[model samples]
Every structure is written in C-alpha cells, then in structure tokens.
Target: MINRIHIHLSLLVCTILEIIPMPISFGTYRPDWLLMGLVFWNMFHPQNMNIGIAFLYGLVLDVLLGYTLGMHALAFSLVMYVASIHHLRFKNYSIWQQSGIVGLYTAFHNMVLFWSQHWLNDAFFHLNYFWPIATTMFLWPWCFWLLNRVRRERLRH
Candidate 1:
C-alpha cells in the first residue's frame, strides 16, 4: 500500500513537471518528464505499475496539457508495454546503456505524438520537436538514481 502511494506520488510530481511552463528559449527543449517516470516505474516495478496505469496517467497528462484526449494515453501505454516486456534485460545493462535504450523509447513516444498531431491537427513537422528525446536521454541517469533511492527508502520503511 505504501509502495503504491510512493509510486503514484512520484508520477504525480512528474506529471506536474511536464505541464509547468518554461521560458520560450528552453520550452522547446523541455524533457518528457512524465514519460521518464512512467518508464522508470514500468521497468523497476512492473508488477505494480503496468500498461493500464500508464494509460491512465497518460490520459491525465493529456487532459492537463489540453492535448487530444487519447494521444498521450496511447503513446504511454505502448512505451510501457515495451518497457515491461524487456525490463529484466534492461536491469542488467549499465546505466549509460540503459539511457540509450531509454532514448529509443522516448523517441518512439515522441514519434507517436508527432504523428498523431500531424494527422489529427495537420501540424507541421519541426526539427525542434524532437529535442525532448535528447534531453530525456541525458537526464535518465539522474532520474533513475533519484527514483531508485526513493524506492529503496520506501521499501526500507
């Protein structure tokens, strides 16, 4: 029960971070914080954090960000499905390697969003739209360490 709360709270924080406004200069580079957290939880605690939970959180993010209702939900669910399937292999990799794989996952997520927006809203593809993939990859280690520490502490208590 406590672990579940910890997971949800962490995800909530990530969701909040995702929606916070940044300066125009940096807004284009904003990392996908919620996606990072979802991947982390899916990788580390798949039994508790599965695709369904990812879907729900994605929907929450969609609503919060005023995006199309199911866009984020679908992307997040697909990413989580991939993460959960290969979590054991992921656990064995070095952190840098893990980050690279996470980059691929983030890329996929971003691609889905971009594709959806293009088809649904006739949005133009911009080179800058993919910046979050690099930023998310760069920040993966720190995010992993913080979440791992929190998970340890929570389990210890």
Candidate 2:
C-alpha cells in the first residue's frame, strides 16, 4: 500500500542520516535519528512496525556502520518492544509528555549501545556519551511534528 511505502521511505531516510559522517568533535552529540524514527513509527503504527522490522532496520545499520551484526538489531528490538507496550497510552499524551517518554526511550537505546560497545570492545564509558540522548530529546518535538505532517499530507490519500 502507499502508506506502507511511505513508512519504509521514512525509515530509509533515517538510515541514511544515521550513517552520514560528522566531524568527530561534534559526532558525540548527533541525535539517533534512526531510533527516533523507529520509535515514532512503532508507537503510531504498531501493526506496521514490529520487532522483526526493527531488527531488519538495525541489521542494515550494522552493515552500513560495519559494527557487530546483531548489536543494533538487539537494541532496536528492545526499543520497539518498549514502544509497542506503551503505544496506546503514548497516543493520548501531549507532545511534551510524548517527548519526555521518547527521551527515556532514546536513553535506553543509547545505554544498550554503550554497554554493547564496552562488552565487545572494552570501550570506556564517559559523560559525553549521554549527549546524544539529550539532543535527541530536544529534537523530538520537531521530528514528530514533521513526520506527522508527512503522514497526514502525503500518506493519507
């Protein structure tokens, strides 16, 4: 269906943004665009966005980023699960409330990535690592509004 294609296209754009290189100095602050997109679609369209879809998207990201194959897949699966659990309640909340929940979701995603990296590579955890969660939270309102607009104006035909 056209709506399904629109959803996939939005995900594809998120993947593209996720891998786009940034200067190393500012890279730590880059929002998790893909995770944000995943949360949005999973929360708003639970039937269309499931754990399997999250895994597939995360697998693509792993291949693109050349990380361990299942790392992101696992994280994304968990994020989707959490979103699916609260989707109904989240739908009725104001944008600010939704963004607050999204902040927690983003933090959980980051926590998974951080622990996985430390487990796989013995990477050191630092305060700077939390920056992305904050940035993603700050950006959630805008991202939600734009994506919602697209779904309404472009996918509602």
Candidate 3:
C-alpha cells in the first residue's frame, strides 16, 4: 500500500513538472518528465504500473495540458506495454545502455504522438518536435537513479 502511494506520488510530481512553464528559448528542450516517470515505474515495478495506469495518467495529462483527449493515452499505453514486457532485459543493462534503449522508447512515444496528431488534427511536422527525445535520453540515467533511490528508501521504511 505504501509502495503504491510512493509510486503514485512520484508520478504526480512528474506530471506537475510536465506542466510547469519554461522560457521559450529553453521550452523546446524540456524533457518529457512524465514519460520518464512512467518508464521508470513500468520498468522496475511492472506489476504496480501497467497499461491501464499509463492510459489514465495520459488522459489526466491530456486534460491538464489541453491536448487532444486520447493522443497521450495511446502513446503512453504502448510505451508502458513495451517497457513492462522487456523490463527484465532492461534491468540487466548498464545505465548508459539503458539510456540508449530509453531513447528509442522515447522516440517511439513521440512518433506515436506525432502520428496521432497528424492524423486527427493535421498537425504540422517540425524538426523541433523531436528535441525531447535527445533530452529525455540525456536525462534518463539521473531520472532512473533518483526514482530508484526513492523506491529503495520507501521500501526500507
């Protein structure tokens, strides 16, 4: 019960971070914090964080961020599904290698969002749209370490 609360609290914090505004110059470089959180929880705690939870969080994000209702939900569900299935493999890799794989996952997540937006809303393709992938990849190690620490500390209590 406590473990679940900690997980949800961390995810909620990530969601808050996702919505926090940045200066225009740096906004494009903002990492997908919530996506990283989802990846972390799904990878290390798959039984606790699954596709349905991802979908719900994505829906909450969509509503909070004023995006089209289901775009994030679909993308998050797919990413969570993939991460949950391969988590054991992911856990065995070095952090750097895991970061690379996470980059791919982030890319896939962005691709799904782009495709859905383009199909449903005729969104324009922009080179800048993919910037978050690089940032997310660069930040993955720290994110993982931090979340892992939190999980460990909570579990020990």
Q: Give the TM-score of candidate 3.
A: 0.96
What's the CA RMSD for each of the models?
0.9, 1.1, 0.9
| Pairs of residues at least 3 apart in sequence or in different chains that clash in candidate 1 | none
Worst 10 residues of 1 by lDDT: 37-46
Clashing pairs in 3: none
Between 1 and 2, whose TM-score is larger?
A: 1
lDDT of 1 by residue, 26-134 (tens): 9888898998898888877889999999999999999998999999999999999899999999989999999999999999998899889999999998999779989
Question: What's each prediction's TM-score?
Answer: 0.97, 0.95, 0.96
lDDT of each: 0.91, 0.89, 0.92
RMSD of 3: 0.9
Measured on C-alpha atoms, candidate 3 has an lDDT of 0.92
* Segments in model 3 whose C-alpha atoms lie over 4 Å from true places: none
